[model samples]
Target: MGVHGTVAAGFEGVREEFSAFLTDEEHAPGAQLVVHQGGERVVDLWSEGVGGESLLGVFSSTKGAAYLVTALLVQDGFLDLDRTVASYWPDFAAEGKGGVTLRELLAHRAGVIGLDAGFTAEELADDRAIAARLAGQRPFWQPGRFFGYHAFVIGALVGEVVFRATGRTLQECYEERIRAPYGLDLWLGLPQSQEPRFLSTLPMLPTPEQAAEIEAAAASPYSLGGIAFNEHAPGNGELYDFPNSRAVRAGGQASAGGLGSARGLAGMYAAAAFGLNGRAPLLKPDTAAEFARIHSEGTDLVGGMPKAFGLGFQSYGAHFPVLGAGAFGHSGASGSLALADPRQGFAYAYTRRRYAFPGGAAPENTRLLGAVVRALT
Candidate 1:
């Protein structure tokens, strides 16, 4: 099926790139792409199997919202990055993580990647439960010595602090200060009324060679990476199915349960960095820079790849050549990518219903993003 949407006059290249990407895929991706120049949406498009407004699981891209909320709280002086996790949630000190500061946790250096006993599906569905269980767990590495991807629990770790400091859940903070104020389509806690718009994320259809590679590279379920992704849990469902559960979406796990369309992702970033809907930017210039600054780099212990992060956000500029050094955001397992390039004066988001091979941001993003830059120039 042909792509359906509108692109501002100068952004026709983006449409071409999007169409070409769909044509190249062996299976339909059910993708949505949106970009905002300051507060103006320059491109809005979707493909077969989904509508432009349909919400899909955004996986770790939800972490971008979690981090953005943290940044706003810091900007308002409600939370201090230098404070120890134990200072906020006292039980966090039960482990050797007493010295681990909010900054260290945001950088993925607190080292409590997962529990010695993996979380059950019910516990994993609740952020507070995840935090409660992990609070007394030991760090995989010496706290503050190294950084790795928290994968499924960063939101809970951070959210616990948010609650202890402000008597509010991160999801509550996000909805009140960010989502509801701007009327963003993204939701940490999806309501029953929005159920009809959500499309279940389809599993990846990897080629034979890709499947072989995946099997060859598979880590033991008990390995650190496995634990981080909750693969070690007995009878745990596939990662792709996490958000499909009404319980997961209702509780709003925060780490990966976010559901929204590309427009919502784009608008959130636009509001945070560029002031969407003619409102003042949610974050100050200094706050944005601090979160965008590189906090960790080099091979990740959990992902086993060269990765970089800034406060809880991925340093997208390092991964996407078309973006500026200040571009910060996150990607999800369903090949979703959303970010704000403050230096470039734009925010971009792409969400796909079908899981992309290799399980991360879809490779087509580079081509699409390059096309956007070309159009802007």
Candidate 2:
């Protein structure tokens, strides 16, 4: 159960248990977890075929990074959450979405969840193409009424606003402002050079009974929008493997398909908590406060579960009860999670090459995290 590397400060057992649990076959094949507290790194650990320099697809956890980018734009007076999205991108008004505000979009309430028209993975790489499709798409529900968990669309919309404000894609803005300045290893649009370091995603394991239930649920109107009965049902899984998925990757959709190391992910959150390792703050104190404040708190339309969403990051109570409101962050499809408690300047980040079984978090993962929290308290 001994972690190979070092634990920064204030946390020791957390790092040890994290490494041990990751070694389990059911958890991350290769993963990293980094934690910081009191302006110092307390637990920086990695194992299970992952190393200090490894990078993994962080899934929805990418939302935190996207949220940071938008927050910066707001702080600089380039974007306003209260303003209509069309004010920035006129073409967006074409689809009866002229009334949507930046806040609704960020909070996953804008309702751009599903694209009626199909897109290839390659199409996602072309920013103009992706934005055009997104802009022309209609909302699944009325804007600002409730949350539907835009899943992938949140990133595209947020990216567009960031695009309009800076005259650069979200990828470019992140590199220029956030990643490069902090030396973060995260990438919205990964370069080809790093492909070797890319860990292949692990497959999900469902027992025959579990798979049957999942299939049934997917077919149910409550799950697949009744599309499960149609021959024309969209296959979202295909979009992940195909090279054409770059369009999805390139769009910087904050909800899914972002890449980074656990260290980099935790580093960004740690900056918000501890204020950037002796550098200028990543966000003003008030801005950081806004980032953690819940924009929408209720059951999600898609997941049909209670969720607490902030400006972009998912709040703690939505899933992990151990994560207090002060501990705000996001989790990927399976086990990937990135969070920081600004109150304590404690950040925890974990990423893996493999996808987790669908249902809840890996028990070993939670058990490890629980031990960490218990130790910290």
Who wins the lDDT comparison?
A: 1
Instruction: For residue 343, give model 2's deviation from the true position in Å.
Output: 1.4
For candidate 1, report its TM-score: 0.99
Each model's backbone clash number: 0, 14
Q: lDDT tens string, model 2, 1-377?
A: 33467864556677657766654555535667776665566777777577778767677787788888888898888999899989999988866789988988888788776566544444444545566787887776787897867665567778888888779887788888888888887777777776676665666666688689878766453252332111133553432242225444444445566778878888888776666668766778788777678889888776777788888877774466666665678887656778877664577787766666563234555765676677678
Residue ranges of candidate 2 with Cα displaced over 4 Å? 1-3, 8-10, 19-24, 125-127, 220-254, 359-365
The ten-residue window of minimal lDDT in model 2 covers 224-233
Model 1 lDDT, residue 295, Cα: 96
Candidate 1 per-residue C-alpha lDDT over 1-377 given as tens digits, one digit per residue, 9 for 90 to 100: 68999999999999998988686454485899999998899999999888998999999999999999999999999899999989988999986789999999999998889988799999999999999999999899998889999999999999999999899999999999999999999999999999999999888878889999999999998988999998988888999999899999998889999999999999999999999887999999999999999999998999899998999999988988889998999999989999999989999999999887787788888898999999988
